[model samples]
Target: MPVGLMLVLAVTLVFLDLPLVVIVLFSFNSSSSLSEFEGFSTRWYRQAAENPDILAALGLSLTVAAAATVIAVVLGCLLSYAFVHGRRRVTRPVEAVAMSTLVTPELATAVGLMTLFTTAQLALSTLTLIIGHATFVLVYVTVLVGNRLRTLDPRLEEAAADLGAGRLRTFATVILPQLRSAIAGAAALSFVLSFGDFVTSVFLSGTEIAPLPVRIYGMLRFGLSPEINAIGTAMIVLTVLLGVTGLWLQRSRRSTTTSNPL
Candidate 1:
């Protein structure tokens, strides 16, 4: 890379990541001061761990993210398959709608969803939150897996069928294997998006259950606390881990495919 380009890239990264670095560092501060860090201590993490409301919100967030990821991955993969294999006349319009969700502002989607739920007499709850998240996340999974599917060799499926494999068998043995990395990436992305969602969760969350992001926002109403920083650091760590795992999976799949070439 050119020195100038490398400098620009380094500056951009620092600009983006400096705040997160500060948050992680301050989370361990012995005092609650945000401007200055005294010394490293796990006091905030301990407090956050002990807080009942934080714990409840964390658990609810995990449950909703997990459920939504599952729903999105399954439906998204099926939709991707249909887009690639189904008739163009029917799939084109559906694909357009799916893609539109990505460009649509999330706040608008949340409002539309809230209105729909109200019209249908559905109450805002964990179930509604999961549905809201899954509805948007499905588009991400579909795009990722569908792009992967489009790049695959169609003759593999034909050969499987020629060898007497049925549709399900061909998909399971041939297509699904090739799609494992894409699916894993999509699942991780979906989980992260759902877990970190604020706009949708804020609108759809019920009285009984609120996700961690919502809880964190509620905490802001009182005042800033070191414990919130600890929670934020934890979330950042999880998101980074998921992203790294997805990249590793994709690289491993590529290596395997290159070496085997079967």
Candidate 2:
């Protein structure tokens, strides 16, 4: 690469990572001061662990994310199958609407969800939060899995049929295996999005339960603290781990396919 391009890349990376680096560093600070780090300590992390509200919120977030991911993956895979196999005249318009969710402002989606729930007399609660998350998350799953499906040779299914395999058996043994990597990636992405979601959670969460991001925002109303930094650092760590795990799964699947070629 050119020296100028390398310099620009370095600067961009630093610009993006500096804030996260500061948060991770300050999470271990002995003092509450954000400006000056007074030495290393795990005090903030311990405080966060001890906080009942934070723990509850964290648990709720995990539950919602897991549920939403499962829903997104199942619905998304089915939608992807439809997009590939169904008539284009029927699927094309639906695909456009589905993809539009990606570009739709999250705030707008949140507001729309809130309004729809109110109009339908559905209470804003954990269920609503999961529904809101899965609605958008399914689009991601569909896109990834649909792309994979499009690349697949349809003759595999036909060959299986010729061998006396039923539709369900063919899908279970052949199609699902091929989609493992995409499904894994989609599930990981869905979980991350749901866990980190603040706007939708803000609008949909009930008085009894709030996700971690919403809980963190509530904490900020009191002012910044090292405990908040600790929580933020923990969330960052989880997101990175999920992303790495997804990539590892995808690569491993590819390697297995290459090695076996069956």
How many clashes in each candidate?
0, 0
Clashing pairs in 1: none
**lDDT, residue 110, candidate 1:** 95
Measured against the true structure, the TM-scores of the candidates, in listed sequence, are: 0.97, 0.96
Local accuracy of candidate 2 as per-residue lDDT tens digits, 85-171: 889999999989889998999999999999999999999888999899888688999998998888787889999999999978998
How accurate locally is residue 216 in candidate 1, as Cα lDDT from 0 to 100?
100
In candidate 2, position 104 carries an lDDT of 96
| Candidate 2 stretches greater than 4 Å from native | 260-262
What ranges in model 1 sit over 4 Å off?
none
